[model samples]
Target: MSATTPNGAPASQPKKTPQIPKGKTELKILMLHGYTQSGPLFSSKTKALSKLLTKALSPAPYNLHPTLIFPTAPHRLRPSDIPGYTPSDGAEGAEAEEDDESDNWAWFRKDEATGTYLGFEAGMRAVATAIADAGGVDGVCGFSQGGAVAALVASALEKPHREPAPSPSPETDTSWLPLLRAANNDAPLKFCVVYSGFYAPPPTLGWLYAPPIATPTLHFLGSLDTVVEESRSQGLVDRCVDPTVVVHPGGHYVPVAKDWVLVLAGWLRKRYDEPAGTAKKEEGNL
Candidate 1:
């Protein structure tokens, strides 16, 4: 009836052990938030999607669970950098900058006249540190500016592994690439999820798209996204070898609706089916 330790003052019932299922799999994903959006804010925005991903992807035998990690961008944007900002909003924008502390964030800041990002190296370093600390991630997802960075990250991991070299000049420092490549236990990310992403047309980053992105990518585009136009998002799709595109009714935001999420889940399931250690088979679209 009862089992007790040494001293026989009283007897107690033995605790029943937990019956856990086997073959259950879990994956960690790195989420890059859009400009002006921090990690916590992005997490709140996609709470529904994260939950839906678990439910839809873990129906039974798959039993797939995902851990999403969001890392905030390091650069702080000026109030003038906010979208829809107008000169009439001068006083209000200043007040907003004084009131809000988290809105002005960016992965890279663009010089309007020159049309080039100024902080690419620093931003990439921050992302690389996050991935290295996580020991690696299964995939990456982003929206808007974050989506552009996600595409580059996946490309960086696709490069051949090499030991990081000495710090090079700002314009010439490709050293971070090797470090990011080495961070994933020397493996490339499994997939990428891009929402309203656009190609970054920079001379230094030309190598990223020289060979079409081989990683399996799922792109979400909004028909009415005025901020990052449909054409720009298509530009990124054109760089991927064979991308799965999902067009939704919304604009410039990740759709967390069940229907839209299921599309992502289906694509993810197909990716999971591929044998581990094997790169996704290239599909012709370029």
Candidate 2:
């Protein structure tokens, strides 16, 4: 049976917890999509990378199978809401936007004036719900806006038992912490990977950065990419206790090539304490 919302409506893309095999652990990764992208789209885009990761981790002392769950954000985005979307002079283009409305989604909308994320709590709730449905996840990965949310999720999971400050306001809404804990059964993520991610600068989000994120983080930056500048990505890297960074030649998208996929596999090996060269050896056989 599918999980439902408090109002009894079916939840968005409820994921089934993958069964763990004998002598092997189930490695669940929550894959969050970027602004304007949906879970299915992200899953399709990262298909190659996902396959490679699974193969890399399947062998020997590292008997791990990765099961990635891509969840669509709760907020729907209209054509006009997209960053580069311009009014169509042609009727066909306008009709296309209206017809394809369901593909566009966002975790939260940015309030340019206050530099805060509007509907941020709803976004967190959506993620927590996904976690609950899946029993829990071992890690998270995201791109662009979703990447920012990935960092927030990792930070929140680190110390979910923490209480809010004496006087809380809209800016500092830590209310989602407990809910997140309950959803994930109080499991802290083993690692997180962010592609084209940025830091939330609003004063309301200071609590997330003040203590800095301790979870192992891997950040990928595109040297020639202009969608999200390097400086912005650096801000996120700076906040991490000790983050691993990989600068790809591409821009604004997750790299799924063999080499890049191996880099990710290597990182995961390090995180899980698996011996090095396991992924490379397995790749050569493939």
Candidate 3:
């Protein structure tokens, strides 16, 4: 079946086939793309990695099959062009142009100063709905800005939403409290994979708190990444409650390194092989 927007725009819903390597247990992996790109863009770009992952997880010495779910970002465009929002050349340019013609989209607005995202709650909710519609997910993987958004989405899911209480006194300070309450009421997410991501909180918006996430996570950063410095990615990794970092020698793009596909495949294999009860127990604890 095809997926389409309310306006009949083409969407990225892939036909559900029996998970590859039938008879083996399957895990659902939701992959989100970086800025200026759609789900199908990443899905096509990461085909090699996905194939490698499927092979690596096969039973015997390794037996596993993961059904990857790629969800398109909700279409959006800046009302006015913002500086530093232009796409780079080559594949990036092609993807950006395609998205632009379709009405350029972004998961959230980027804060130029700290690189933190703003107005991400709406995108997060959309992603959550997509995942639920796709039959839930065993794990999530994202690249660059997608990575930052994924982390925030995972954090949001772990807390329960609470209505903000109004303060009678004008002198009273209740700014941060409301945000904290909202973030404290979300659902729990499983493992996450972040590539070339930054971890700055939103400016003056206490709603964008980065709680100590307990989900197992894998972080990949390019040593030569200028767009998102390795130091920044490392900082985010350090803040994660439990995370493993892998440093690749290259630039910002994931396909630049030859071994990245292998590395990512291995990570996915490990994530999808965890006992079913473990995920359930973790969800319960959250």
Q: Which consecutive 10 residues in model 1 have the weakest lDDT in total?
A: 4-13
For candidate 3, what is the TM-score?
A: 0.70
- What TM-score would you give candidate 1 relative to the actual structure? 0.81
Model 1, total clashes: 0
Candidate 3 per-residue lDDT, tens place, 1-286, comes to: 4557763334645546664565677767778788766677788888877776776666655566777777776645542333365555465656545543553456677667766455565556557656766656667788887887766656545545322235444643334333422432333566788888777554432343445566677788888888886676876787677576777777786662336666666655555555753433332121
What is the Cα-based lDDT of residue 183 in candidate 2? Answer: 86
Better of 1 and 2 by lDDT: 2
Candidate 3, position 154, lDDT: 60
lDDT of 3 at 50: 78
Order of all candidates by lDDT, from best down to worst? 2, 1, 3
**Which ten contiguous residues of candidate 2 have the minimum total lDDT?**
277-286
Model 1: per-residue Cα lDDT over 1-286, one tens digit each = 3332232111222323323235556677889989888777898999999999988877665678787877777776656677775556357756566434434567899888878788887778778877876778889998899999999898878745322333334556766776677677778888999998999987677778868887889899998898987777888999997787878888888999988888888778777665753323522221
Please name the candidate that would achieve the greatest lDDT relative to the true structure. 2
Task: List TM-score per model, in order.
Answer: 0.81, 0.86, 0.70
Segments of candidate 3 deviating more than 4 angstroms? 1-17, 78-100, 111-118, 159-187, 203-211, 256-258, 269-286
Residue 81 C-alpha lDDT in model 2: 76
